[model samples]
Target: MEPLLLGAVIVAAGGFAFLNGFHDVSNSVAAAVRTRALAPTVAVLLAALFALLGALLGTSLAVFFVGAARGLPPGTNGLAILLTAVVAASGWNVLTWYRGTPSSSTHALLGGIVGAGIASRLTSGPAMEGAPEGFLLRLILPLLLAPVIAYLLAYLAVFPATWLLRHASPARVNRGNRMAQAVLTGVFALGQGLQDGQRTTAVILLALIGTGSADGVGIPMWVQVFAALLLAAGSLFGGWRITHTLGHRLVHIDPMRGSTAQGVGSAMLLVSGIVLHLPLSGTQVMASAIVGAGANQPFASVRRPRVVRVLLVWLGTVPATALLGAVLFLALSPLLQS
Candidate 1:
């Protein structure tokens, strides 16, 4: 692979990481800010710092994601496929953020890879090997199961959280929960970085492997640093549109319930990304948890219209990005091949 092409791949991957942080990690702080647990600026700053820490400290997810790229076409063709996938995922992320809908960045990238690989095979006779089966068992199964699990976990958690604080006065409960939520939001952001940062690392690693610049045994230190910094930088900017949708439009909850939802969401990310090495959408997990916690409370009610809208967008994300990826690959094929 040419130096220019490799550089292009790295730049594209960086952009995707940035947008992932912007669209997804920023939401981790929404509940904290919404419940007045933390000031908006302070929450954002906390998220940025922890996300950077999580990215630098985590490596298991990067190793797992790289396995998914083993089927890319070798050499420059592989770089093009990777680039198109990142662009497709990034584009979809921006659109959803602008529309104020929460969608899964994980699904978008997976779908993009599938679409680009199929498009490449149709035109050039090479596709992502074992894509359908691998996606079903490894990616889709976990993603499909995660939100349901997150919802249930959050719903059940509310019972215990509320119970423990039942003897306390409302003012005391509110004050204590605010402090708890501030901490939960930081943990949430850390997990977000741990999960999303590895994605960028995997993309850049694939680029290097395609160019024969590095063996694919492990992630390079500089790649991790670059990915970590870019992800954190993106978090600094934040995505307030979707944050509003999550914090205000989707559900209403007190500080205790908000903390419950964030706590559940944070635990889900840590367990899935680290323990199981599974890919999950922080956006989807947190959104579902919020709804789950909100619906269970007698004083709280979910906004059905907003819920439906967000759900529809979530369901459409993968297929839409797949088509987008295929189209992008086809349009850029000549340049990619040359």
Candidate 2:
């Protein structure tokens, strides 16, 4: 019965991870599609393929960081926490996607984990010491900073590109930028796979440790391959509504601006993945990059109100997921304990 229950929970978590990949697909490919660098179908395919490859090749640093750096005691209810986090994050992702808003799956997961941890503490009595300061400093801080840095870098990259190319013919600019956007789109997809894929990997590892399958030291080959495939399939399906919102409503992105945003966002994710072992949000980073790129243009060209609406969604994701996780955990605790 315990094994069955664990299996069920892990499968559900995997499903949630796939949904996360589906919803956030736009963050990586929207710019390319919108800039006419790639057709929608091709963009989705490329994003899915590259994301899968990135997941397969990249190290599972984020999972290790989550488990060991969090300082959770052995025998803690990690399975419950993993289940709650996945449910909360997935629920939020679907909701925001439906609303055509790009919310951070990263933030949702963070909220879910913290909510479950708090609830577990209340129920089980002060168990784990919570995530370490270094984890927060190294991981959480980067998650927070990446979007802002992406924004700044994007602004800088776009402004100069636009200025230098102003003397060029419109047709030439368009052609050059279109090709550049294609390359940037691939980089963005690679970064997305590195960052977002790691988050899913971390959650799966948490589930494995919670269920007592593996010692969180390393993820099994089967688990890794399965996760990569699931996420890639989800990315292939893509999120058209959010893609439209990001591609059209957020800002008018030319090839240069799109490239700048993609490059900046990719840099942030790569740094986090390789250096800090943090799992950042591709959606948040790209959105901010888009906004930053737009800010470089004339005020009239930037859609401030629409961007503000997206920001509002971002602010709400954490609290909303936390509340949902708490409620769900509270309702389930009795049955789980029994």
Candidate 3:
């Protein structure tokens, strides 16, 4: 029973990573594709390659999820919490993907765990008490801050990028920016992999730890490879609906602004994942950068209505997924606990 539950948790984690790949690939490639810097095919392939590299290379941000896993009640309860969290997050990802909304998989994942934790504690008593505030401070706060920072950085960077090319011919400027955007898109994807790939890997690790199959000392190579490959595979599938929203509906950006936004988004993701040991939403950061870069244009070009809808979804994702996670836990707990 324990082995089966553990297997379910790992499978759910992989599914979430795949969903994450399609859901968030827009963040990495939308700007480049929209600017005609890279064909959609080339952009996706590049993203897949780098995303795999990024995931396989780093596990710095796994600490938070691992800590969360350790906090859950041992045995079936812990496995169920992990399973339901991944399941709930994956459900939200599918819904958002179907609706063409670019929501945060990071928040959804965190919310799932938190929701399941809270539900477990409430129903099963103090044995499952979990630190929701710790999740807030360590993971959520950084994720929330990353997008705002991305927007500001993108907003400021665009001026200099535009001014530098101000005197250049439009043809020459577009060509150069396209090339730069292509490179930066891959970089952005790499950072994204680093940020998101560790998330599923962490969940899998937590399940292993819970079942005593492994200690929580370090990420297993097989786990990293599995998560990375699934994430890369999902990237290959690409989420064109959300891609349309990101590249077309959310903002109107030229080659220069698109390049600038990609650059800022990539830098933020890399820094947060590698240096700060933080888990952030590549979707949020990239989308915020796009809007910021577009803000310099006519106000109408920013697509206020679409932006508002996106923002509302962003604000609701964590809480909504939390509720979903709790409900899913209630629904699945009987089977898991039996």
Candidate 4:
């Protein structure tokens, strides 16, 4: 690849990472803002700091999991696939955010990648061994399962915690739970940094390898730190649209319920990061947890229809973004080559 071409690809990938940060920071700050644990600006600032820290610390595993082992090969096709994926995902995120819908940024990216991968395979033939299955099992499966698992855990956990705290004075319980909420929010931020930040790192590394700037074996420390910082800075800007959607509109939340939801969501994310080696969506996990927590409240307190609409969007994210990515890649293929 020409130096200019490589530079263009790198800059494009960095832009994608920035967009990813802009779109997904809500996952880290929404609960905190909703429960009044922090003001929106303060919450975003804190989450951004933690997210950067998490990204810098955990980018190596991400490089191995998504860049080298996944479907993308080290060349123009891979670069195109990654670029298309980010564009499609970021576009969908902006659309949903504008509508005040809290969709999963992780799923959007995953779907885009899948779509781009399949399109690339169809057009170029398979360039590497076991690419398809690797993507399906490693990337797609976790994207599907993380929310379900989070929902169940949150439902079960909140009910018990509610029961245990039921007899306490409302004011006292609220204060204690507020403190707990802060801790849980921090955990969620950490998980977001570790998992979501890594997805950007992996994609950027894929671009680097494709351009022959680095082997796929390991990401450079500078790349890891820089990517982390970019994402963190993006998070600092925060997505107020999504913050309103997930934090307030999805369901009404008290401190206890918010804590329970954040705690379970964080746990689910960390588990996925460690065991599955996949980037799971903190937004989806937190949403599921919120829904589950709401269900445990009184029947009248929960908003069934609203929850249903969000779920519908969640289900559609993968296929919708996948189709969009495929189409975009197809349209841009000639231009990319030129």
Question: What's the lDDT for all of these models?
Answer: 0.87, 0.77, 0.88, 0.76
lDDT of candidate 1 over 1-338, digit per residue (tens) = 46877898899999998898898865688899889899989999999999999899778888777776677766766887888889999999999999988888888998888888878887764666664566458867888988899889999999988889989999999999899899988899888889889989999998898888988997889999999999999999999998898999988988988989999999988988778888887888899999999988877489999999988888898899889989988987888666
The TM-score obtained by model 4 is: 0.90
- Cα lDDT tens digits for candidate 2, 97-134: 89889888889987887777777777873455756666
The local lDDT score (0 to 100) that residue 178 gets in candidate 1 is 96
lDDT for model 1 = 0.87
TM-score for each of the candidates: 0.96, 0.93, 0.96, 0.90
lDDT of 4 at 82: 74
Better of 1 and 2 by TM-score: 1
> By TM-score, is 3 or 4 better?
3
Q: Supply candidate 1's per-residue lDDT for 255.
A: 91
Say what the RMSD of model 2 is: 2.0
Per-residue lDDT, model 1, residue 299, is 71
- Model 3: CA > 4 A from native: 125-127, 132-136
lDDT of 3 at 254: 95
lDDT digits (tens) for residues 1-338 of candidate 3: 88888999998999999999988898898999898999999999999999999998777787766774566676888888889889999999999999999999988987888888888776763346546776648866888888799889998998898889889999999999999998998899999999889999998888888888888887889999999999999999999999889999988999999998999999888888888787888999999999899887645688889999999999999898899889988887677656
- Pairs of residues at least 3 apart in sequence or in different chains that clash in candidate 1: none
**What's model 3's overall lDDT?**
0.88
Worst 10 contiguous positions by lDDT, candidate 1: 127-136
